[model samples]
Target: MGRLAVGGTRDSVGVLCQVLKTGVPSALLTSLSLAQNNLGHLSAMYIGDALAAPALKRLRKLDLHLNRLGDRGVASLAEGISAGGGMPCLDELYLGYNKIGDAGARAVAGCLEGMVVLRELDLASNAIGNEGALAFAMHLSDEGRDEERMSHVRPRLLLETLDLKENRIGDDGACAFRDFLACAGEHESGMGGGRTEEEKIGLYCPKLLNIFLDQNRAIRARGRNALQVLHTTRGIRCMEGADW
Candidate 1:
């Protein structure tokens, strides 16, 4: 549909309460950019709580940039998103210029595990460092394990696209991420239930295509080579820098 940007100090909490209470759905199904709106951590929490309205589920893109949502605020927002649910259809999420450190990134990583359909996520300029990146990588590894266990009895999950730009990830964090991707790719390819080689390869080929890991400064030559190995083995293309 269209987009919705609510600003001005008209008591954001009150507005959110009204929106949730009245259930007035916006008629747009596109993006929701709330950047440069001076939303502090508390305001962001309130706004996130207000977004529980079912109407917000129609949004495909969401931007909450320059809001100064610190670690606590980011955790609150992620919790709110999980509680609100209906984010299965969400494609892109932007949370740049906040103060989300490692704790905040861990919270986001937790939320991401639940969003099986999410494609793109942005966490740039948020004071996220190697610890944050490592936390996220650990989350992916855990997710891969969970997927493996599930595939033994049920259907598998598909998750693609992730962005961690300008987060100052170090070499160790980069290596961890690359390792997780490689292992996940292998597991996904191998979990075809004893299918033919061609069938297994087909199932594995396109799954990694949807993953995007761009803008990790600590990604050195070895890390890049590891990613290349994953690409060659799994036939997945991981984008870097502004390629996304």
Candidate 2:
């Protein structure tokens, strides 16, 4: 029911493994921090397995910053969380300062599609390019494509904040975001399905309240128009460059 911070401990992974092995009610644990531990793919796999325990149901916040979890590790962890049948309560996830790239980001987007309650996701400094950003933008903002309507259907995210600073998001990715935001706003305004505001928020994403895309210089150079379009939208807040 409280926070657990054990960064810099050489045996932090061991501690978590012990807890998992002992069948502790990690469900009651709200936060887990394993920052600056030099943890790699192996440690991530162990953590992945631990998170599968049903007893870890109440875990809402997870910090895995400053580690060496490569794309495989990232994919493994995402798979575990998706299949664990108990990460539904997770609201915040920190994967910053890792060397994650497009492949890992795509995997994450695919795996976490069912986690409707996730609110804040941080992927700063991950070297994620346009492909990765587009994957996330498309994944989080869409439920499915409707062949009949020739458009996207709905979104499953209640996400309020997202961080993508210092990555490689480019013009194409920015266009995806522009389209996503426009569609999201249209849906949120009670124009789609005749749903109420609360229903819109609970069903399709209401459009995020805040997003951090600062320091992705490529967007500035090539996607300024799309960024401007995004900036002009009312209600939501988007951060880019030195602002926000």
Best by TM-score: 2
Q: In candidate 2, how many clashes are counted?
A: 3
Per-residue C-alpha lDDT of model 2 across residues 125-232, encoded as one tens digit per residue: 888888887776666554333345335443356788778888888788877776666456454463446666565443355646666777777776457567566656
| Shift in Å, residue 122, candidate 2 | 0.8
Instruction: Please give the CA lDDT of all the candidate structures.
Output: 0.63, 0.71
Q: What's the lDDT for candidate 2?
A: 0.71
Q: What TM-score would each prediction reach against the true structure?
A: 0.74, 0.81
- Per-candidate clash tally: 3, 3
Candidate 2 worst ten-residue window by lDDT: 143-152
List where candidate 1 sits over 4 angstroms from the true fold: 13-17, 27-30, 84-86, 141-159, 185-216, 219-222, 235-244
Where's the lowest-lDDT run of ten residues in candidate 1? 199-208
List runs of model 2 lying over 4 Å from the truth: 8-15, 143-155, 184-203, 240-244
